[model samples]
Target: MLKERLYYIDSYCKTFTTRVVKESLDNMGNWNVVLENTAFYPTGGGQPHDMGLLNGIQVTNVEEIDGEIYHTVAERLDPTGEVEGVIDWGRRFDHMQQHAGQHILTAAFVELFGFPTVSFHLGKELCSIDIDVEDVSAEQLEAAESLANEIVLRNLPIETKWVTETELDQYSLRKNVAVTDEIRLVIIPEYDYNGCGGTHPSSTGQVSAIKILSTEKQKRKVRVYFACGGRVLQQLQRKNYFLAEASQQLSAPEDSVNTAITKLLETNRTLEKALDEAREALLSFEAKDLLLNKERGIVKAVFKGRTVKELQKLARLLVAEADDVIVLLVAETEDRLQFVAARGAAVEMSMKQVSASALLAINGKGGGNDAFVQGGGERTMAGEELMNKMLVSFNLDI
Candidate 1:
């Protein structure tokens, strides 16, 4: 016979005495305790299991399998005697508020718009519902949130009743029941009627309030993030802390934080653009100087702690100004080496061949067309030494 689930009979019961019928080890080697009557709710219907103490031993987890609710514990209790079962009321009530709030908010969405909730997840910090819609707007979310809070304010009674599959036709269910044998319907008078096995509070007011945190498009549906009951206050405090820190860092008042940040970002962008232009001008002058000092028709240069991008820009500038020049540059960081090889329009050298041969010195990898090639690898030698080695491989006089 199936043990009576005391949680279904009284969701508000925090403490109860139940007889331990069986004790065994699960597949994972965890101790499982089965009770004749249990107040603990198992993990089901997207809601987590209730954690509590059984005969003073901590119950870590609870799961239902084949009509049996197994309470995972660390130690075994006397199977022949009754044990005191005390659930963590705070955690249980928090989950109840979130679960009930979901019902009201979901009902509000269906009543206001035509969105149907597809899935739900009650997370540690926040809860979310996936709606069967392509998109959800801010105004729509606000309207639903307002309506849900109105229901909570009205203190509408949240009732649960057991029904069979045949009796389901008497109620307008928001979703199909998962079980046909013993279906439990959670109803909110004329507002909501849905098949649910999860425990809920006695009234909607116990949910306190509902706040829509954010929403995003997920596949063909929309996932809406929200917080109910105590979670709403927690989210508010976290956001307020962030805003306060940002305002302090920006040296702006709370009311003007947004304006101050916008102006600061604009100023930063302007400065970045000006700095980029200055850097480009400096690179052009350096390219000209290197060209003036070129040995024959080739310009070879080595730099310390320079980037591959800078080397590419310098090489491009040099080749653009002189058509008969070949540019080979190497940059050396702490333990890495980078090089770029390019030929001017009038020069007809195979840069790919030169790059392949040079890469052998440092076991590097890179690719490009004949006119321009860039690569990087481990620094086996100094930047000047690597550059000389590349010139020798290219068979060019430096």
Candidate 2:
């Protein structure tokens, strides 16, 4: 039988009494560590270790290296003093809520959909559980979530048992794992039964609520991120506050606020779509005019005070439709200028030639091709002048 003392003592552990198992000197010979029989939770499973005191020496970190627990302290204690272990129960229980909530949520996946909770991670900022599944339909996930909350409401008790290798076989367990002679099984009543060594709540009802925040594909499985208990309460409060603020700003009632916002968004989308089509038509007309009105049978475009790719697309479209076959367009953002060139024999304009006259004339920089070349010039009020200068390099006047 394992002789190690259980810090969780059949309930929530706040303080503990333990003998100093051993003392060791570090490689640097500067810090000393005291291993003890019991300890607060350590920085494992991505959750931070408890920080309080071991015999008033100010414990910095506690780690379970091997099968023993070592408490790292800031200052050395008198070797003879009794090691009294105190934990930050508030933080410990906060993590308990999260871990326990994970069980409730994951079990719901199994109880409702027969999906197994493949792996789990309790991160510092959040916790996630992975389940093997090809497609997680939103409706199915929602139903699973509803069942999870019902378990929370029912508040089924949470229990842990130390079972032996032979006893493990008696349960018809889910697959199998490489565990020690004594395995700790976290039982979720009729919902789940899995081996875990992490701290958790006394009952599922203590979780109060749960939310499957999001799910992401993890190889052959799906990782679900969730929050529960006190954290869920905090999340709801923050969400309600934002909704109330939105309702006030939009001058809508709380119950109808959702419908009102949806309608408003649809209306805005329609208007924006119509406006975009109109703008494209106008751009097309101007592009056609540019090709026809060219003095040297070359069409060029230069837009100033904006950095957008739309002008490039317009230029390509124009070149495709026109016959003489040269399309050049450039735009300048606050930080830099860029240009795109297309069409017949555009590569003749070298960078130096384009920079010296074409782009240099407009004071912006960029050039490329026998069919297309780009260069950058300094910012100036006249961008069309740069295009004109570039055409000059090709021995064409416009």
Candidate 3:
């Protein structure tokens, strides 16, 4: 078959109609149609397919299989008839926005840190690029991101060129060229020259903004995730919308809202602390009423379905007061049971066994070490029954 002239050769060529040469569906249910010639760029180089229309049907995907490129249409077209393929300018331009930003950002990393991007994955959420480097500190990440934004602000001219291996011997490629034989290099003027098969914008100035979302350490590699162009602007627009609403409700400017909230939070924290201290003092007085009578020699305390924090705090208080110190704390939240027991050399208590029994009763799981025992079983039993079972099994005075 004669090779079709790739209309994408002219990245600026967005509108073109071509005859559908062949179409088939793979086992994965993706449609593959080879055109006589196509302006639609297939999924490649961390960029998505250039989606558009095929004879008025929406073209959702374009892919390559076994060196043959295919365009997936929304509806089945007459394989025998000539079908017109048109590129969706809105979608194509959005992809270009992200692609161009990525090139500039990736180039900035190499230029500033001497580390090159090993691979890039573009997705709807965020575009991620893995760099060849150890774990990058937050500050180091900030620096790279800062540099990328600086380039974005600079809006340097971006240019694309196709050069033969022999002719390009004088200039250095960004990384190892997989196939230097016939390479299409996307150039950012004085910034970068990388072998890229994806379509790109005419210049960097088209990418209005770039934002670094976050970075995570994946194994030994550092992955930097970011958003670019339209996505960045979209996020800012949403943020501003919320800010405006908040500013109106709070009677403040968007800039001072965060600072104002921070101050309010600090003041609230002081008041909350004072209230907590007063409550604790009152709780200590009421806790004396929960004192267990020493008969056969068991120190116990009764508790309602409370938080572990409250129970633990009471246990510590009782442990300090008891001479023959064996303290068992009980709390149940919702349907779950929690038990905290601690003995300070005054009694022998296996924490693991206690945790086990409590878990079995509640149809859950828990464990602890020596000097502390805790058990929780199903919440099938009410507060009274649950407390009674623990007292009988653990041989404690309720």
RMSD of each: 3.2, 5.6, 4.2
Q: Which ten residues in a row have the lowest lDDT in candidate 1?
A: 1-10
**lDDT (10s digit) by residue, model 3, range 126-201:** 7989998887777777787788788777777777666778767756778867765666677776778888877777
User: Judged by lDDT, which candidate is best?
Assistant: 1
lDDT of 1 by residue, 1-398 (tens): 22147898889999999898888986888899888889999998889999999989999999988888889997877687779999999999999999999999999999999899999999999999999999888899999999999999999999998887999999999888888677789999999999998989999999999999999899999999999999999999999999999999999999999999899999999999999999999999999999889998889888988889999999999999998999999998899999999999998877987798778888999989999999988888888888888888777646
Which regions in candidate 1 have their CA more than 4 angstroms from the true location? 1-3, 19-32, 74-82, 292-307, 329-339, 354-367, 375-398
Q: Which of 2 and 3 is ahead in lDDT? A: 3
Order of the predicted models by TM-score, top scorer first: 1, 3, 2
Error of 3 at 327 (Å): 4.3
lDDT of 1 at 251: 93
Segments of candidate 2 deviating more than 4 angstroms? 1-11, 17-34, 45-48, 51-63, 67-85, 123-126, 137-139, 146-155, 188-191, 216-220, 281-302, 317-322, 344-398
Per-prediction TM-score: 0.86, 0.73, 0.78
Of candidates 3 and 1, the better by lDDT: 1
